[model samples]
Target: MLETLVKNSRTSVDAGVYEIRGAARGGRSIKWKEGRAALITEVKLASPSAGWIREGADPEEIAASMVRGGADALSVLTQPLLFHGSPEYFARVRRSVDVPMIMKDIIVDEAQVAAAEALGADYMLLIQSVFDGGYAHNMDEFIEMGHNRGVRTLLEVHTAAEFERAQNTEADLIGINNRNLDTLEIDLGTTEEILAGRNTRSRVISESGIKSAADIARLKKAGAAGFLVGSGIMGGRDIEGTVREMISAC
Candidate 1:
């Protein structure tokens, strides 16, 4: 499924670039203020591990709820085949909320970066491991493409080696994903294990498996500047109330 998504995305590179060039650009810039762990709530519809999360969910409604709940930013999944998301979801949510929106997808081509800009995304994700899979081959060029379009890149890494490689890039943010892609297992300790005894000035965002306010506080103590919680909030009955609790914990 991942391979097919990468193949299809690469084939539309030129078209994606052309579309973004013709589209207007302007969105809220993220400001990670001190004294709180910035929250990046996600508008995800489904995943391989969790299957359909919030089936038939409204992206705009969920985004607004997140914003009202005090989310610092939003991450909207755009991987259609597996995640059941589309660029239109980002656009829909953009119109509903003013917070920074992240184009959360397994980006494999520059065209997707352009699509993100055209869709009004304030930030886009670039996974370091995908380079090994023949996607995002030119890491520097990929990062530059987003930067040139005024879209900040969030370099996501799952291992220590990937983290090391991500550190060399000029990414606006660094995300440490606790969920192992292969096993689909999440361990919050992964965030601590990687950040232990490290001195990183760059903003660090802990991703995956964050369940409660204590989880946020633990990561904050481990040097994480923010938290990206998706299923924990989206799968819940009350998104706004859950988000508020998470924010207050931060």
Candidate 2:
């Protein structure tokens, strides 16, 4: 799955101006303010594990609803093969809302970093396992590229080892993803288990398996600084209300 995602990411990269610019919304740190945990919602159309999530809904509408519900930020999936996401979707959502936005993709190549900058993403998700797999450039190189483009990085890790390595990087946010990308399995406790030893939780954002306010309360008790929810909000009957309820947990 990782190999396929990397190949898909590489094949999709296109040349661009790669212009250097300052942070559009004050450095991706805008998601966390007043010392309160944030609700980072997502515009996920589908996933390899769940398949066709809101297969026909407009990305702009989904993002607008999330903003209406007071989402602290938005995550736009950019992978196209299995996830059914595209950079165009990110661009559409980028134009629709003002909340801090993240370009969520299996980024292994530097061109993806340029794409994130061109799309005006405040932050780009960098998975540690991708570097651990030796698929492309390491996290440090991508993080530097993103910094040069004035795009922050959300370093996502799925294991204790990866989390440890993530702690040593200059990533702006540390994301603990509960879902196992390769096996398509999810365990919400993954966040708690990984963050148990950390002293500061201010920059920790828990991802995956985040469905309800109860899940939010549980993770909050475990010291997660933000929640990156996708399928839960997208799959709900009411996207706006769902996001509101989740934010209410904080």
Clashes of 2: 0
Summarize candidate 2's per-residue lDDT along 1-250 as a digit string, tens digits: 7788777777666432233344234255454567578999999999888899998899999999999999999999988878888878888888778888998988877767877887889999999998999987667988999999889999999998988888889998999999998887999989999888678533889999999999999999998989999999999989999989998897
Counting clashing residue pairs in each candidate, in order, gives 0, 0
- Native-vs-model 1 lDDT? 0.83
- Give the whole-model CA lDDT for all candidates, comma-separated: 0.83, 0.85
Candidate 1 segments whose C-alpha is farther than 4 A from its true place: 1-24
Error of 1 at 180 (Å): 1.0
Off by over 4 Å in 2: 14-28
TM-score of every candidate:
0.92, 0.92
RMSD of each: 2.3, 2.8
Pairs of residues clashing in candidate 2? none
